[model samples]
Target: MKDKINELLERVENFRPKAVAEIEDFRVRILGRKGELTALMEEFKSVAPELKREFGQKLNELKRRAQERVAALRAEAEQAAGEASSQIADMSRPGSEEELGSRHPISLVRNQIVEVFARLGYTVADGPEIEDDWHVFSALNFPPEHPARDMQDTFFIGKNPDVLLRTHTSSIQVRTMERQQPPIRVICPGRVFRNEAISYRAHCIFHQIEGLYIDEGVSFADMKQSILYFAKEIFGEETTIRMRPSYFPFTEPSAEVDVSCNLCGGKGCNVCKGTGWLEIMGCGMVDPNVLEACGIDSKRYSGFAFGMGVERIAMLKYGVRDLRLYFENDVRFLRQFESAL
Candidate 1:
């Protein structure tokens, strides 16, 4: 029995496992219930009384050595695993590119439009999405019974007709006039809400950029030239513009502004519906009544205001057929504008 104990001690001291699984197997074979160490402990009870002390001491030392060997083998196996994992990676090679996010299509076009106007000395302006009727309609020469004031066209807050979501960014122009004196040149850009059904071309919510230039001796010609410069900058150098007489509550001698079709060099295309033209915005001289309502002296000052839908501009520029794409947060659709940024 003493010789068997000495042999087992030598085995424990030399024990080494190449892997974590072998280390666990070694532990179960020697130290587990019904294992070698447990069997040896049982055998000690049959030893003679005089020999018990010496055998007991040997058994305790063997058990201690077996436990220490198992622990060392486990640590070595873990270290080997870590080294193997580290070798799987190429430390000297270039790293994989981290994916970069991009600006939304609407934002890209909006920024481009703002940049074009910024070059012309027009400062950007903003206003609240929720507004009172006066800033949106009343102060803009909208009559009390105007159809736009109705709940069917405008989104009223709660039961109050006077407070509602702005149907257009023209509200910001009114706010600007109310606070600033003439010689005011500002471009209002923001989101507007309407009580309308959503569709590929139309939505309940949209963006608009409205420009206002008020000062002594401002004229329709100045507005036309300014718009022409903007059209050429946005579309191309050869682009041309033609205004058709139209009507708006806030602009006298109003006209809808259209640019020659860029898709077909103004010849014809399905995008322009074969008309060789595409309407872009609305513009005209500011109505005296509108100017007077906002505390601007109509007799002393005159101005022109023009407004265009930002989503519409984005669609024209990017050839996007669906207005809904701008509002949907689809990463695949938005990623198309990464290069545009």
Candidate 2:
């Protein structure tokens, strides 16, 4: 019994495991129900009473040593595994990671809008979010008396009245017109800012996509047909549209564009406020004055301009009641869009 105890103690003190399989076998051999230490304990239990205490003590020592050896073996095995894993890991190999994102509702709508217009041969155009007055309001035909220049509507960077944050993507249209000649076909998409109280429906900042097309003899009929086609593509083939006469400072004979409410199928709903039509955009013929202001001859150049709010379109499409939700960055709300497709 003493010999066994001494043997196990030496084995435990010198214990080392080179691999996981060896550690597992060591654990079973030491701690298993039918292990050698357990058999020794059984033998000790049956020993004559005179030698019971000494033999039992030796058996317990052997059991303790065996347990310690098994623990050391396990730790050594794990250490070896870690070292080998580090050596064999392919640092140059392409990494595989989780696919954890989906397009945001706003991005989805924006891409869809771009795609629809792309099919119609309009190229995507971009400009700086921070822009100047000449391109934004001046070329777009804002009158000198227009209140938008009063510093209440625009965010100015430098003291110069020329440099300011763009309140509309109309600035991009102006830039495009100044650079590109006739047969101009471009869609400008960008961020716009306004000073407003954040509310369920309104925000101080938002996104807008504006389309401009200039060529010979572009008419209100052409504008209407283009909008109708856009409405059909966006809403559905069955969707109907109605143009409500409206006014804008830039475009002559401006009208608000609306689509038949999909939620109620034009029957009227809370979304449409019982009108059965949800206003989507505002558009009109490019004013002759605006054309002249942008260096395009009004006599030779006739075009149409249309603009829509991205968040508004997204809200109507997704039924997201609160505009604040778009900016909150709440994971719970964002995760709902995880499977956007």
Candidate 3:
């Protein structure tokens, strides 16, 4: 026609396209539909009626310069692919190692027994894993036919049998001796419920910490040198402790405490099954009817209470012979305590 519309408007002003699939194959070779401008609009309907207005204005200026040269070669191929993806994107490196999370080996032995009794001043107290029956067993002296106030070992909570759940965090030391008083050096920790029977050494939900130290001349040799400086700050400095004469309707001449095994340094093994000793807690001296049922004048504030089992001191500090691997949240047994945090 007009020399094929000036050779497709000089091939659409030199259509240059390095990428975006060559600007969609140059917009399907100029607006496709059997394109070449739809075969020049069927050769301008058999051109001839007085050259149909100059080949209909040069075929609408060759279809508007083939749609503005395929929209300027698709914006210069998307700005050279966003500057080659921002020069291979190295936004100051350091990124993919992300997997951290560790704690719960019964909260790392209950925060290492509340940081070894918070460096001996104790503090931290808390209560209510749903209790009653006088802060869990008649202010700790427990006897109302005590088989741990049975319903096959307490969980009671519904038909009002004096509510239940707490089978011991000594009901947060009888709710911190019925609302603090007595220079009570606290420590209680938490989570305790027992209807029992889930084993690898028992559990129906567990955890307990308990400690109390009422003021004014507290003893049993100051609870045996504060549990032998808390068993040499948790089993080390060549630990040693002994106590034995046990019983516990809230401690009184009660005792149990063992420690001295740390796996064979006591010269025995099979994890202390060979009698190097390991028991680990339950102390004595607070029961004058559990300090007169929390009003504390049990012959004037004589104190000492102890307790353990933060998953039995995190299975004797991580030798962990399955207390159901601290409640089976097993990410390969919690990624082996991720380097013990």
Candidate 4:
């Protein structure tokens, strides 16, 4: 029995498992209910009383050594299994899936707006973001001394009056006029630049879609009907618009269009500032001077022009409280519109 104990101890000290299954087998052989340790413990009672102490200690030592050997074998086997797992893993298998991206909320809204107008026979016209004063302001009937042309309000280029960042998409309207004659019906959408401090309510850089409709005899009434139809189409059929007198350089007797707040349902709310209305856009009959400046026969061909801040329209449509949020590329905020897409 003593020789058997020493031999088993030597074997345990030298034992090494190459796999997890071998370690499991070793555990069951030494530690399971019917294992070698249990068999030795059952034989402990048969030893002589005088030698019982020594034999008992030997049995305990054997058990301890067996446990240690099993633990060490398990650790080695686990490490081996890990290395083997990495080597044997199916490298040909497809990698983990990557998340897909979606259209931005602002982009989705812009497309919707353009699509709505497109359905009404409007063709899209684009122009340069960096434009000259003649195309941006002067041709659009902006006075030479207008504050918009000031360096403090406009982004001037090379200290020249003829060159500057376009302050509005209406600049595209002027460009379209110079390029196309009467019977021109088009929508201009582009980025506009202004020299204003960024804030929750306003941005120095924003987007606008200005609409121009020119023919033989366009009037304020035609403009009104068109705006109303657009309002109904965009804001739902329940929408109502109120046009308040306003002013713009290119439009005579210009008006600001306000739609009944969808959020408050015309009962007044925080979004509408208790006014039950949200200003959507500014519009007016194209001043004859503007038409004449673009070389159109002002008397024979009267037209109307309307311009709206795309951000403003998006804000009103979606109840976006902060203008800065649209510019911030926060994934969480944009993900809210996932369903909106």
Candidate 5:
């Protein structure tokens, strides 16, 4: 029994494990239930009484040395593994190529549109998405009976009908007019909400960029030239614009602005519905009532306001038919525009 205890002590002290698994196996062989150490303990029970103390002391020493040896081997193995891993990391080497993020298509288009207007001497303006009825409807000259004022057409907040999500960025223009006087050349770019079904061509939540230019004798012709210049710059140098008579609450003489189809070069295409022109925006001379409502002298200050959906402009530029793609955040859809910036 003393010879067996001496053999185990020698084995435990000399064993050098190359891995953590080896250490676990060694521990199980020495200290686990039904192991060599357990067998030795059982054998000790049958020993003569006089020899018991000597054998028992040797067995306890053997167990203690085995446990300490295992702990030391484990520590050494872990340290060696950590050193090898640190060597492999190689901080001097260049890092792997990272997947770079990109600007959203909506943000890209909005930035482009804003930059175009910025070149035309128009500064950006902002207002709250949630607004009062006076700034959204009354200040904009929308009549009390207008369909837009109804709950079906607009998103009213809580139980109060007056507080609602703006139906258009035109509210920003109205707010701008109330604060700033004539010679106010600014563009409003922001999200607007409506209560409508989602479709390829339209959305309940969309972005609008509305421009307002108010100064003495700001003519419809001035609006025409500026829009023509913008159409050429954004669509192409060869692009042309035409206006059809239209109506709006805030504008006295409203017209729908259309640009010649750059896709078909005015020869006509399916995108234009067999017509050479594609509607892009609405523009008109600001109404006298609207001017007066905003504290601007109606007779002295005249202006033109134009509003277009940013998504609509992006659709035309990118040949994207589905409006839902803009909001979906699908990687397949977004990856295409990574190089656009």
Candidate 6:
């Protein structure tokens, strides 16, 4: 029994498990029910009383050492397994997908509009949002008594009221004509300001893209062809346009341009107010008074001018009813346009 006790004690001190499973199995063999230590405990009862004290001590020491060694070896084995797994992993593999960002819907539509006109020899023109009455109204044939000159319709900057926010990109066209001579072809795209009430269809601040073309022999026919081509290109090849006689301060024989409702296929709907048409822009032959005001010879050079609201175009193209959506900066609303190029 003494030899047995010494042998088991040496086994406990020398035991080293090659794997975590081996450590658990070793524990069961040494300390579990019906195992070596359990069997030895049963045998200890049969020993002489004087030897029982020494054997019992040795048995208890062996059991404690066995448990300690099994636990230590199991922990070491598990740590080694974890290290091996890490080393074997492929770090070069792609990680979890990261979401990509996109341009704002308004920007995307603006760029598209510019690209469309760019192909037709129209260079982009820009001007300051702030302007004097001359460039914004006077040079554009806006009479002093025009309602647009009133504070109710326009944003005045100071007590003098001459300095104000431009109500249209036509100021850019006026600036262009002042610097350049005839044969001028430019498209003005910019932000404009007004004093209108905020609503789903109207805003105090908005964007406009107005086009001007002045050269010899330019006529109303040329304007019609050009606008027709633009309507077709923007709303789809099947789109058609009609010019209803209208009025504007800067243009003679002004007409409000309407395109067949692309949404309802011209059959009439709530969007088009069941009219089977959607008002898109205004167009006319540049009023001679406007040309002379900008230093161009009204007699030698005849041209056409057209203007449209960028928000209105976007609303039609994207089917967004509320004009407020363009300005809200809501992430959820913006995320929907992520797929738009």
Per-candidate clash tally: 0, 0, 0, 0, 0, 0
Writing each residue's lDDT as its tens digit, candidate 1 over 1-341 gives: 89889988988888766657887888898899978889899999999999999999999999999998888787777888799878877777898898888988888888998999999899999999999989999999988899999889999999987889999999999999999998999999999998889999999999999999999999999999999999999898999999999999999989999999899998899999999998999999999999999999999999999999999988888899999998889889988888776
What is the lDDT of every predicted structure here? 0.92, 0.85, 0.84, 0.85, 0.93, 0.91
- TM-score, candidate 3, is 0.38
lDDT of 6 by residue, 80-177 (tens): 98999887777788887989798888788788888888888899999999999999999998888999999999999878788999999999999999
Clashing pairs in 6: none
Q: Candidate 6, overall lDDT?
A: 0.91
Give me the displacement of residue 126 in model 6, in angstroms. 0.7
| lDDT of candidate model 4 versus the reference | 0.85
Compared with the true structure, model 6 gives a TM-score of 0.74
Candidate No. with top TM-score: 1
Which residue segments of model 1 deviate by more than 4 Å?
1-94
Q: In terms of lDDT, which candidate is strongest?
A: 5
Model 5 TM-score? Answer: 0.73
Better of 1 and 3 by lDDT: 1
Residue-level lDDT of model 5, residues 220-278, one tens digit each, is 99999999988988899999999999999999899999999989999999999889999
> How much is the lDDT of residue 227 in candidate 4?
89
TM-score of each: 0.74, 0.72, 0.38, 0.71, 0.73, 0.74
Flag clash pairs in model 2.
none
Which candidate, 1 or 2, would have the higher TM-score against the true structure?
A: 1
